[model samples]
Target: MSEANIDIQLLDDVMNKTVVSVEESKEKIFEIAENAHKENNFITLELETLRNEIDLVITQTDELEWKAKQARQRLANISRGFKRYSELEIREAYEMASQMQIQLSLSRDKEKHLRERRDELERRHRNILNTIEKSENLISQMGIVLNYLQGDLRKVGIALESAHHHQLLGIQIIQAQEEERKRVARDIHDGPAQSMANVALRSEIVEKMLNQNRIDEAKVELRLLKELTRASLVDVRKIIFDLRPMALDDLGLTPTLRKYLEEYEKRHHIETKLTLLSPERRLQSSIEVAVFRLIQESLNNTAKHANAKQVEVKLEFKPNKVLFMVADNGIGFEKQAKGERPQFGIMGMQERVKLLQGTMKIESKPGKGTILFFGIPLRIEENTKAGGSEK
Candidate 1:
């Protein structure tokens, strides 16, 4: 062949190889993007599921805690009645206390296991999120390269953009998860752990009193120990409930909110009222949880920052949506002031509403109290079944 013909043949061969390589790269990038998306979604679901499990375990711990208190109270009463009561009664009290102690041990073990599982799931979630970010970055780079090639690379660019958006969302979710985990850890350390330490000290006091042959004093000390145990159990249950309320699952939203509000009022001495304009109907589990957490966080803020005494929570069901409003008669801050921006709690609530494809509004002034309104779209199918059972 002539030299010119040979040059043309060589050019054609090079072009063919380049085309093949580009096709292969495109395929690989698409595969990675698909897999990363799937993995990220799976991780998100798994994290949510893990959270639910943790909530259930915490609730069980709370019940066991209450049972422990009852046992302690019985034991204390029996000790008081020993001088005037039957041997059978005393024996029964001891048996009850022993059973309660065993139950308490099992509950603590379950809680520990749940915490470990939460940590593991959190770590896995973080790793998957990081992987998604890297995968998106690689896809973006591939998109840039594909732009220089011939024929229909726009789809790859779109895919790259979509992946980037998902990666950002994943990052946001991970940040929220981390914040929640930190909050829970702080609560456990400050509330339950401290209370437990106090209980231990009280128990030691009772032991020393008995050792000194002070039966009457030891009885008094034991009474004190019983009270301390009850209080500690309450603290632990509050911590656990704050993490997740089983009532949200068992009693649906309205009853759960009522119970929480009642408890909140009793705890903070803040007069609270819950008004339900909508018929008692169940919502999607995710929606129920989000609404519950939103209200919980809002009330917590009210209790902590709001100097007001009365809080009102309202739930309304519309034809195609559900609306939640938490109005607190507190010293509301300036919603528009640059120095008075929304805090993490408010932002977290907003994030949750957004996840449900909802809109949230906060209305507050310096002294007019604060009112938060958020509306979430609801599908007709979501109102299908009620939750498990009433708490």
Candidate 2:
């Protein structure tokens, strides 16, 4: 064959292979995007169902709260009139109080479970949306290359590079998700699950006392049960809020952060100070969530690893951007190379900032404390500004 013919055949072979690889990559991405869209829809329906369940539980809780309050008042009145009442009347009063206490405790537990379910559903929904966005972006980038290449030899190299980048991103996302799942599972086992088990054991003890005709002892057990249940309810609510703070939706970012830091300090026994430099204003929902998670992860890391006595967080709102910093006075460690074993918390924070087209920097030394700084541009919509003013 002529040299020209040989060259043309070689070029044709390369083009065919490149086109095949591009098509396969496109198909894979489209599959991912479609699955993500379906998951998003499923999560939306689940969230709606969860919200209805939560509303119902809230109504029931309110009723129980009222009834419990009334029962307590009746018990107090009975105590004052005990000298004038018969033995049966006093026993009946105590019995009524015990029943009311048990009922209220059960109702509160149910409400707590419902709220946790709702929060988990919401988190899943956010994750699905993120996956969809990433898949769509990858597909769009490939389309641009496909349009511009027109069978060029370099198309193969570019397509391969794109595919590799997408693969790495997918791995990173999966790793982050797994890490999150582990954290949540650990928290549930240690916090609410343990609390619930204790409640069950106490309830059993109360039942045994009542069966043995130890009315007075049973009454005391009931009282202890009430306190334990109330405390457990608080713990469960805190877990749910940490999973996804409702204040982030109702009160906006600044208020939510302030409230969270206050709780964090009390819980961790680490003095935490928050400074807000901007006039309290709301940002887009996505940005608000990202910023909240960034700070949350930062403080969590500090609590677990820093052993610091105090941590400082600051937020500054700019005309077209927002900046955040989390600093801790604790034993620091050597910074590892980016390619080293991943620090999941730090990596997750970096990924969140990257998604917002923002910048993140971490500074640490063996003796000095660690500092994390991130900034992201904000597009202040008219409606957002108006909403801020209302707040």
Off by over 4 Å in 1: 1-161, 204-221, 339-341, 379-391
Please give the clash total of every predicted structure, in order: 0, 0
TM-score of each: 0.53, 0.49
Pairs clashing within candidate 1: none
- lDDT value for model 2: 0.79
Candidate 1 per-residue lDDT, tens place, 168-251, comes to 565556556655765776677567655665565556657866889889988987787787778778878887888788988888
How much lDDT does candidate 1 score? 0.75
Q: What digit string (tens of lDDT, one per residue) describes model 2 on residues 231-284?
A: 778878877887789999999999999899998999899999999877767788
State in Å the error of residue 17, model 1. Answer: 35
Question: How close to the true structure is residue 287 of candidate 1, measured as C-alpha lDDT?
Answer: 80
Which stretches of model 2 miss by more than 4 angstroms?
A: 1-182, 205-224, 277-280, 337-339, 379-391
Which candidate number would show the highest lDDT if scored against the true structure? 2
Candidate number of the best TM-score: 1
